[model samples]
Target: MASKMTSGDLDEQFLTCPLCMLHFRDPRVLPCLHTFCRECLQEWATKQQPLECPTCRTQVSLPDQGVDGLKTNFYVNNLLDFVAVKKGAGPGVPCQVCEGGQDGDKSWCVDCAAWMCDLCTTVHRKLPGTKEHEVVPAEVLKAEKDVSKFQRKRHCHKHKNQELVFYCESCNALVCTACTVVDHRPGNDHNPVEVSGIADDKKDKLRQLLSHVDPRLKEMQDALKEFDKETMKLDSSRIESVNQATSYFQHLADLLQKREREILSQIDATYRGIGRTLESQKEAVESGFSRLASARTFCRQAVDYENEMHIVEIGEQAQRTVEGLLLERVNLKPEQDKVQFSERVSVTDFKNDVERLGVVSSTVNVDVSKCRVVTKTPVVGLECTSVLETADEEGQAVAVSREAVSACLTGPKGNTAVPTQLRAKDEGRVWEILYTPEVTGRHRLEVMVKDRDVTGSPFDVVVRSRESAVITIGSEGNEEGQLKKPLDVAIDGDGNVVVLEQVNRRVQVFDAGRGNVLKCFPIDNDGLFGTGTDSNGNLFVTSFGESYGIRKYSQEGELLATFNPEYLRHPLGVAVLQDGRMVAADKQQKSCLLLQPDGSLIREIGKGQLQDPWFIAVDQSRGLMFVTDNRAHKVVVFDLEGNLKFSFGKRGPNRGELNGPTGVTLDPAGNVIVANKADGRVQVFGPDGTYLRTVTTTRGAPHGLALTPDGYVAVACYTGHCVELYRYK
Candidate 1:
């Protein structure tokens, strides 16, 4: 039978099926408050050992003998009935009020037995004086109360008209009002609602609230799962590094790349010549296209007039070109495409060959291309030649230097002794005796830096040496006015300095010439991103993932795409390959990720035996990838197809061994420089894993290191406030 059902004319939208993801009709509301469709449940019950509700995931214990009885529910039948009537398949009644609400508060009159609203009180008494038609509110009716039947089955409420029938004390039911007046009311002062099922109703609601709270609490637990790891809890190791500020770019290196220089310079010269030509052409076009001519003369010249008789008379054809004194030739070449500006600002860099070192953990290995760091003590001679003594009006220009060295003896408190192993330039012998350092630890050897023009600036390079009695040298820092150690460094295509900072989540880009920061872009605030620049000047960053994935950003630092697929976990290193693809090394996930240009997931590479690929480097030309595993202390090699090819390095503090090596770089000469962050040194090795010399950094906590194309070493130290640029002397 169909039934008309409505709830005040407002239609309600329902969630259809979780499987099909549609709005539900014919809802089969279960006791668990989850709903499904009749056909859906029957299909699920077809060949089942046991039946269960698909929505609430509740197990159903049906009687084994009768399968049909437990297959469908009355609630679903009611929904079907309502829809059938809505389509005019059955009765059409205006159900202005909903059948639900106020716990079924409205009740049907015994005379009519039809539903009635609160305003239908007058109609409810249609047949008045008929023993005050037994009445009750709708909520009491939900308890399945029938007032007439209940009254007939009990005593009157006002008069206690049970004829003194006594209520049974054991049974918790109303017998007679006469019994309540006599014995029931006085004796039943002890928790009466307990017997009336009110206590049971309250208990049911409390149980419902408890069940609801549990799932919400579980959802919160899922969100906090990533932070419950070993690494994030510990203090970062390289918080104590030193620094010196310098900027070394790789332009000179590009100037000598075989025929590449000549080709590019030829193109540049052609462009310069084009610029000169465009300037002249633009002037001519502007003068001719201007409105200096008369408008009527210009309009007359825009068309041509010829007569057929004149053409025939002048041989076979005669054509005359129209000319007005004010009108000239008009040549519009579409404005040369409006001198188009690059929509993209090549935040990458003005130059093309240089690239930023990707972001990495402080526990990865770094390589120095062909650049080598060596220690040598230059010969010294102190013969004060007074070329021309001039009296100083403002001040006299003199060489001033201060150094702390236990290797060099304190010469007579004030005057420093010039070592005996020196000869003058006039002696015709320049490379004479070597004045090596005396003591054992890292040393600082100083010489007075002087410029012939008296306008040159001064800086220092810390000399580091062991007991081999070899002279040591390092690029300088903290020289009263210099910045301390830098936290991180990234280089763009033009060899511009970009730093992924620890204290803040900003990617800092600096000019190569001045070493001054030009722009800063912010990334994830937790500071786990590996940053790299693309050829189009876009910034690609890899940071730790909460739900396990990588995030990409534009050069202006806008979020482009994010994916949490089966890629690397806790990614730390990010690099853009030449093919516009992106790669990242995840430290905790122990793998690397590959991303398409649109930030789509395009296969991940290097997983499984990798413990912690803290930093990843890509040599796109060779289709080879290098990932540094911090705990294993080796570099895992992989091809573009995610195949494991080879591995390098082991866990140890030996010369070739890595001790929490943090940064890795491939110099133009194809050598690898490992910035052993813990060892305070950069270990250089050949491309074939040959043991090259080590350039010891005197700076503490030297975490990041890179080889500039110009053969300078750029190091990021944690404790120092600035990045140090080094030139190998």
Candidate 2:
């Protein structure tokens, strides 16, 4: 008897045709080397010409006798017969060909896929149709262990007696001997080839396909992992943002609650104070009434007395008491306290105060083209106009519509001013804003287009008695009052304009009101770059190139002190705080230096962040220092402690863009004014780095910047060789 088939017997299952999902029936191969069941191949061939392989789509040409011309896989037939014999020979297996009672199987027919008993087996072999069928000994089949080498072939469905042994290339069909002659004749242009010759080639093609797909599959897997990691990061960021917002709002809520408690406490105290005053007045009035009642009771008792002597005795006392009571000034009518609260104010009034408790919320405006101050003369108690150009993101002008644009002017005291008139013009691209300031000072004009702040909006408008440059100083020359290559200009504490001449190597002091040179002194070094004045009218100058240090001199040109720190390689710009601390821009060091009054270096700021820092300005009120990074094309702001606060500007030729920024100073309105050497314009910014407006334009490069006490910007034009003055606030 044959051994029982185990799981190892199914090792040859991969040999099955994918199309039929079964053992290859009449196994025949295509040119691509892929094998399929004879009937499946025949059906696939009917749909196409130039016969493409079902597995890899490789085209094939068939021989004339059609499928009958292809090679038969006899090796598959032998293996199938061997497996059938082994399976059928197992104990207790019944003969499938038996008609009545079950019988033990002795052999199996591979082509018919059935088991037969010993008697049936003999009959099967003797039959004329099965006379040539190959049969293997059942014991011999069970002796084999490795079943991977086996292949099974099925018989032709149409002609059960004959095997499918050929392929038709034209129809991509497989056929039996009878089919080849009937349906796929040589005269019908059918091409056929031996199936066994192409099997190895098709197997090689499948391996190549797997090699190409492996790396791509790995790439997709890696990408999915990266996506998961990024998604987690985004989720964490979202949670953190939400938490921060919650904390901020919670702080505001706590403040409001504290304020509410304080207000309620004040209201309670006022009510108690008034109540005490009324109670004291009532007590005094009640005491007077009690005394009057006693006096009236005494007079009545004296009248009721019957005896003459008793009446007389009591009458005298009663009369004295009555007279005393009448003349004692016991006033019955008391003046009302009149201590009462006025009616509670209207809800509108309370709302107005409550709304002003916090910052005025301005609408976010992004659709803006340009914004500029249009008022030629900004004087106190006079109307000033600000013009805003409105445009969509695509640069097209918006149509006329009310509330499409809104603007609010904030004064120096942080109060929003009501505009007298706001109207749109020029196809809604331009908006006219007019308002009359009540008091003289600096006013911030904020204009919005489509609820978005326009470019250079919120300008600093200086409202004063007069708004014009008092005088102009210096020209192209080396003569007494004339200047040559004036690099920097500054206004001293005594209202003097100190101009540093680079080529002439001299410091010239000019009367700011007259523009007349008051004093001119030649310096020993030719590298004088910047000039500034301290609060005590002391002059400070910075030298670059061969002599890299900051020199302090008296108003009369006497050198007071010199600060040459090791870290300060090339000092280019200098500014003095009110407390005498100095901020110097060190070009070679690529940093800004904060120095004590004694010329000692305190700290170095923006070390790696600045590239070619050229100018420095200190805003003492805000404790901020603005430095111009010339090469980096930006203005970096820092606190007094040298911590970076924020920065703005980039390398471009557009508005709010800075290219080769040099001189820096703060206007009277606390706006940072920076000179753009490349763009030849003076750009102004709010104290917190908001771009305000471009105050003025210069023909040549504007370098040294100084704001005069009279609200004017003195700009020293390097290429123009002159100092130009413009009214700024």
Per-model tally of clashing residue pairs: 41, 16
Worst 10 residues of 2 by lDDT: 357-366
- The parts of candidate 2 lying over 4 Å away from their true place are 1-470
Cα RMSD to native, each candidate?
36.0, 41.1
TM-score quality measure for candidate 1: 0.35
Per-candidate Cα lDDT values, in order, are 0.43, 0.64
Tens digits of per-residue lDDT, candidate 1, 1-729, equal 112223232133333444445545344433233445645555676766566656434455544543333322222333233332232211233222343233223444433234444445445556454336554444444443211122111233555424224323344333344556544554445112222233233233333333443443343233233223212322221111100000121233443244333433433333333333334334433433232221212121111111111111111100111122123332222112111111111324524532321111110011111111122322112111111111111222211111110112222222343242323221111112224433223323222111111111111112333312121111234232233334456676677766666555556666544466566665655644466667876666655546445566665668887655554557677777777888877666567778786656777676577886666666776677776676787767788898987777777767788776677767765667777666666777776657686766545566555555544566676665566665432
TM-score of each: 0.35, 0.37
lDDT of 2 by residue, 1-729 (tens): 123333364447534776888777777644333456777777887878978776545576665765555544443444454465566667766777884224443654555556666777788899998866754445655666543223234456688877656655576555667877777776558865444444333333333333443443344345444434433444344345334334433444544455444433433443333333233334433443444443343233223222222232233334443444344432232222221222232333544444323211111112344234353335555565666655433443433345656777767787757465787776455777877777776777776554446677677776654333335577788898888889999887777788999888898888765577889888788588988888789888888776778888888889988888787788888888888888888877788888889878889888898888888888787788888888889999988898999999999988888888999988666788999998788988888778887877787688999887856688898988878777564
Native-vs-model 1 lDDT?
A: 0.43
